[model samples]
Target: MDFVLVHGTTQSPAGWDRVAKLLTAAGHRAIAVDLLTPRDLPVEGYAQHARDQYDGERPVVVAHSGSGVLLPAIAEALDARALVWVAAYIPDFAGGRSLRDEASAVLEPDWIGVDPTADPAKASEFLFHDCDPETERPALDSLRLFNPAVLAAHPAGAAPEVPSTVIVPTRDRTLRPDWLRRAGRERLGVTPIEIDAGHCPHLSRPAELAAILTGRA
Candidate 1:
């Protein structure tokens, strides 16, 4: 299947390095996109590029992290066959609630060090809930700094027009499994698959994640 891999907040095209390699090796076409965000444009503006790039291909959209906000827009614009969300932010596409607000409200008050004031890169731990030290070390170290604006916008959650798959990182603290399901997956006909990993499954569990994508698991 042709694929469009959308990285989470502030993530450039390099973030999908591992995923792109795996998908291509499996004989699938993958287009890893880097939307221009953190600029003066609105989230809708970024969403437009995601739509325009897809052309006429019914590609599978794999979204991670803060890119969750764009799902509604992208899904609406493209003739999407399927979407696989990896530890992504699932928001109310209609009410337009920021993914950040939804995640903060869902996480219990006990989880501290969330650092609402800190940059997204420094707060990487919140996304990788149960990842090993090795898998997370470099990712956390190279985390690109971006403002919270990506997650602060209203995500079009009224309803998604396409079928989607939501892979919940079981240990994800950034976008909790429960919240991800409720926020959008269940509404969008997505079969929520639970994986024993942290936020970035493509980075740490490429084989398992690829299997799921290929329908072998």
Candidate 2:
């Protein structure tokens, strides 16, 4: 199967490198897209950008972190086979809330706002705590300051009718694991698959993530 890997905020397509390589080695096509900048573009535009990255068959669209808000739109645009959320925020289509609003309501006030690109030390500690320095270095370097408007933008339309899987990084320090579990059950309507990894599982647990992506886990 083919896979479209979308990275989270403050991240780049390079974050998906290891997982993509593993999937490609297993005879699956995986394209990690750079979710375009000028972040104020309509959510549909972001979806279209991701779709244009792969010309292969319909894929399993996987979203990480902030990219989750755009997942439903992206899945619909690509006519994806499935939707996968890895340590990602699951949006409520009916709520008419922005990612920031939703996150603030459930998360501790202090956790709600922080620029990931502002502090490399803090970013590494929260996002890559389970990762080694080699993995942490590039991820930190790749952090880009996305517009705050992106978080304030709401996801458009209802979630597409498709099979969806949410993978919770059990040891995640960034997005609280307990909050993720509640969000997965309440919004996505499914129990999440748990992985013993931190926020960036693609970097921290590539082989295991690849296994889950390939349906081997």
Q: What are the per-residue Cα lDDT tens digits for candidate 2 across 1-217?
A: 8899988887878889899999999999989888866556778888788777779877899999888878898888899989999987777766666777666654534445666678877787678889887887877766775544655567435756888899999888778888889878877788888999988899999999999989822
lDDT (Cα, tens digit) per residue for candidate 1, span 1-217: 8878887764456667777788889998888776754474566677677776666577787888777767666765666777777777666655656645565665544443344225544446465445466756645543554434655655555666567778887776655567776754455666688888866777778778887887721
Native-vs-model 1 lDDT?
0.67
* Backbone steric clashes in candidate 1, count: 8
State candidate 2's TM-score: 0.91
Q: Candidate 2, which segments miss by more than 4 Å at Cα?
A: 106-110
Model 1 bad stretches (over 4 Å): 51-56, 93-96, 107-124, 127-142, 148-150, 155-157, 184-186
